[model samples]
Target chain A: MEEEAETESITLQDSAAGGRIDGKWGYIWGAYSVTWVLLVGYTLSLVLRGRLLRRSSGVER
Target chain B: MKLPFAWEHLIGVIALLLFCYGQVFGLFMVPPDAHMGDVARILFVHVPSAWNAFFVFTIAFVCALGYLISGRKGFDHALEAALEVGILLTILLLMTGSIFAKPTWDVWWKWEPRLTSSAIMLMTYVGVVVLRSVVQDNERRAVWSSAATILASVTLPLTYFSVQIWRSIHQIQTSPADIDAPLRMAWRINALAVLLLATWFLARRWRIAARRWELGDAPPLPEPLQPEEV
Candidate 1:
């Protein structure tokens, strides 16, 4: 049983590593950057909204 | 209340700055892919957006659960805001993924497991939104929205495990346990981006809810009475 499990694990590792490194690093990175843009944009939006809310609330301290 | 740059807001800003730094490192400095060329760059955006959508939805679900268990209006409002942001992120994910898919798959759409599950996930969130809008009273809206949020969580696990549960052809290059050096850096950056965005949206939405609460339970402004004949 242990031997069977070992073999299965090796096979899974092999399958996981089967892919050749594709040459499209640019697109992969671009997709990542797009996510960053969204994040930054959203953060800025929150900051703006927070400011608005505080002003409206007029709660000191 | 006090100037909006509370500690949380400051932390959010710092996190966002770090996220930007990561984006620059991931996009410009990262080496190109040997197989997919520049198109591989799409993963930086597409993967992160998809993950963020799921993260937002999960938060929404938890908030809804909090409301159900504790009956806090804050939790209800948080659930609503989280759902709103989740829907936005999900829509962005679908659009970006579609664009990425077109070049790689040689077609506009494919009924693949991830894509299909994501569609279902989106539909469930939309239903939650509709339920919230239809309800009249604030408490009723909160109750209905919370229920919808809780129920919609069913789609979350499905969307998350869809690839593993089914035989998916889409490449599963990045796993947390074992990541290649280059891909690892890129993935980390993408994650940072998601975290920053999620924090920003949550904080902003929370503030909005706080503001609404502070305003008290006043009924919405009656149609402005036209100035009575002067």
Candidate 2:
């Protein structure tokens, strides 16, 4: 039973290493890039709209 | 014309810097998950975005109730701003979740209970925004949107607990006790950063809505540029 458990652990580690070798970095990068773009873009849109509204209302801050 | 720096500007700058710091720490300093490998880093942003989405929805729900009770236009403006930010955060949550799913679940999308409920919530709020636009009278718009917001918020709690309540491929919600110390730290930091950023955005949006409300229906248009003098 102990030997069997050892082999199973080894197999798990091997598969994990294989996943790293396969390089799924693209997925990670994609997720981060998309998040950054969406957040920054939305914030910029809000800022611009605020400026436009202020200009239109002629409310000098 | 250069605008003077204000407290909101300071808050915005601090929020941006803190978020960047959190991202760097999360991506590089925290150890990768044994099962998920480096891809687990996505949790830094994804979880926080989901939390903020829920938070903003709760704000919208409260504002909706406030409007009903007080009949104040300010509450309506606050409701609309919160709803708008909540929608944006929900979209971010969905997109990030999809991206994370592709690697971890080996599928880009799934029609599981959590995903389905979240999508429904997103659509319901989106419908509220559209409903507000379609209605012409201010009182009618406020009444309709406030009612819709309250109705839509029912899905928020459902979506939050879907994974636990139903059979779902999505992982159960993580708590500080469940995560490693370093990961917990990074997650908490990022959560705070996102919350600050959301607060800044919410403040600006609420102010803009209030200003428009004050301006009434006919806001003056910009004057056309005159021809240069010969």
Q: Could you tell me every candidate's TM-score relative to the true structure?
A: 0.77, 0.86
B22-94: candidate 2 lDDT, tens digit per residue: 9999888988886778888988999999999999999999999999899999899989899999999899889
- Give the docking tier of candidate 2: acceptable
- Ten residues in sequence with the least summed lDDT for candidate 1 chain B: B216-225
Model 1 bad stretches (over 4 Å): A1-61, B1-4, B213-225
Fnat (0 to 1) per candidate: 0.32, 0.49
DockQ computed for model 1 against the true two-chain complex using alpha carbons: 0.23
Candidate 2: segments with Cα more than 4 A from true spot: A1-22, A59-61, B1-5, B219-230
> In candidate 2, how many Å is residue B141 off?
1.5
Model 2, span A1-61: residue lDDT tens: 7975575556445434445423477877888899889888988988888888879887433
Predicted structure 1, TM vs. truth: 0.77
Cα distance off (Å), candidate 1, residue A46: 5.5
